[model samples]
Target: MINISQCYSTGTIKGVSKVGGLIGFCSNTTITDCYSIGNLEESPGWENAGYAREYLFRYFGGLIGTTSLGVITNCYSCGKVADVPYAGYTQYEYHGFMGPSEYGDENTVASLYFDVSKAGRTDNFAVAKSTQEMKQQNTFIGWDFIGIWRIGGGVNEGYPYLLFSYTPSEGLNVFIITDIGLKQVTEMYLITDMGLKKASQSNIIADTGLK
Candidate 1:
């Protein structure tokens, strides 16, 4: 069992059974405050256990292929899920957030969300919302915006960005005047195309000190 949180994926994932954009299979694990923004391209099935012909099995999701005694909460996926066509098979199965919940009781998963307009899937386990709705901060009921996440301001293409990706630089000096004493904090400087800039947790302010 493991706990994963405050992360996201922006790459493609491809496989057969137990295929997903983020994690193929999860067992007794807890995933929270994560999302997948890449595409899930799964190939047609693989060789069956004993049969010579290739066949596709259950379990394929945009976020997770299968959940076995696991919990996923406050997580969402906005990736398109599709399967490559197989010559012999006519039926293809796919999902938006998760393929199937093979184990766990009723409280295993909670507050899972997905973008219906982006992922192009609707499943019972996920609450679907439009692209615009996903961009809004209020769409996520229990998410922390002040400390753990950020919206807009040229990050994640309007999607929520984890605070880990928005850490304040440790090179710039900030002078703070207090009743007790004065404090100066060093901040990291970021050289961008615009010019030298000071990066903070909320925004990046241009220094404009050099041409």
Candidate 2:
């Protein structure tokens, strides 16, 4: 009743039956990097006009009939599907990306973000450094995350409480900011191979030192 990474087709068959790129019916399986492009409509056997029932009982998707156990990642479809009306069937069915008959299983997805500065819209979700023109002043101020830079004075209080430090065998110094306390590090003046150097605590002192 369940299969993983498999492809199937119910060639030229006509009826109130099921067909899909992955499986006619799904159970405990994972489908990744899969796709389907075809036409699906209600068969003469059923009164329903669409390819699938909408309300409940019946579900259909372009790539899969139902997903229960497996995760579908990096998968997409460009197919035409429609639901039709019949005399006996009152409940409608779904057309695209239908779920499994039951809920609760192993399903997860990891999405990628694109760097638009370098390659523009054509870039396919690649990680790249920011250009000089894109680097504004005071980018990384109070942000706790690695790749986020905060500028200005609205940083949440109680942050950057210096945690434990250790030097690995390769002479790489690792510093963890465990507990975030009030009074965030306002500005990061410089960052080099050594470490990050903060700006003055007070604006007045920072201006005085600059002069």
Candidate 3:
């Protein structure tokens, strides 16, 4: 069994058949303390977008797709899980927590929650909670608060973050430029114990010595 914990996804993942926001397919797996803040769309491609037709089976889950011989605990998804509006003979098996749990004897999923307003379905597969409930710590039972995770203060905004990123001192400053390319001839400033150092790199990874 595969054990997954303290992981999250914030980007859109689109696909069909055993598709999920966290894992596309799962069997004999155990997932805990995970979340997805991205949209999970099934059959994203257009019917006539160079393809003949969409897949006949579209099984999608907010956190995990088709679960068989698996266990999911203390996981949540705040993303939309549904099939795109496409005119075709496409089948859908979408769920808030997981796609149809086929083998009830082998698969066990508990404490799975989703945003009621965001997620369209409120089936027994996963519990539905309000947006306010998601932000509160008490809402999630058996979650690690001291060692593994922390919340608030714009880290994950209202969500919890991994403890490795926690800092008691001043936080590190990060800046990004979308237009910049590798070896594009640009200057950079780095902070060192000595002082602010101005340097440039022929390659992004190579050091150019302190100045």
> Backbone collision count in every prediction?
7, 20, 0
Among these predictions, the greatest TM-score belongs to 1
lDDT of 2 by residue, 1-211 (tens): 3434323232332224444433556665665434343444555645445544543334444455555655554343333433435434312243443333445454543321111232121211112223321122222232233322221123211111111211123222222243332222334354545666544434334443431
Per-residue lDDT of 107-211 in model 3, one digit per residue for the tens? 777877888667675545678888777766677676766666555445554665566655533332222323211111234666667788764443223454322
C-alpha TM-scores of all predictions: 0.69, 0.37, 0.68
Measured with C-alpha atoms, the lDDT of residue 123 in candidate 3 is: 49
Once fitted onto the true fold, the runs of candidate 2 whose alpha carbons sit more than 4 angstroms away are 1-3, 6-21, 47-57, 86-92, 103-106, 109-211
Provide C-alpha RMSD values for all models, in order: 8.8, 17.6, 10.7
Candidate 2 has an lDDT of 0.36
Candidate 3, position 85, lDDT: 59
Model 1: per-residue Cα lDDT at residue 11: 90
Q: Residue 107 deviation, candidate 3, in Å? A: 1.7
TM-score of 1: 0.69
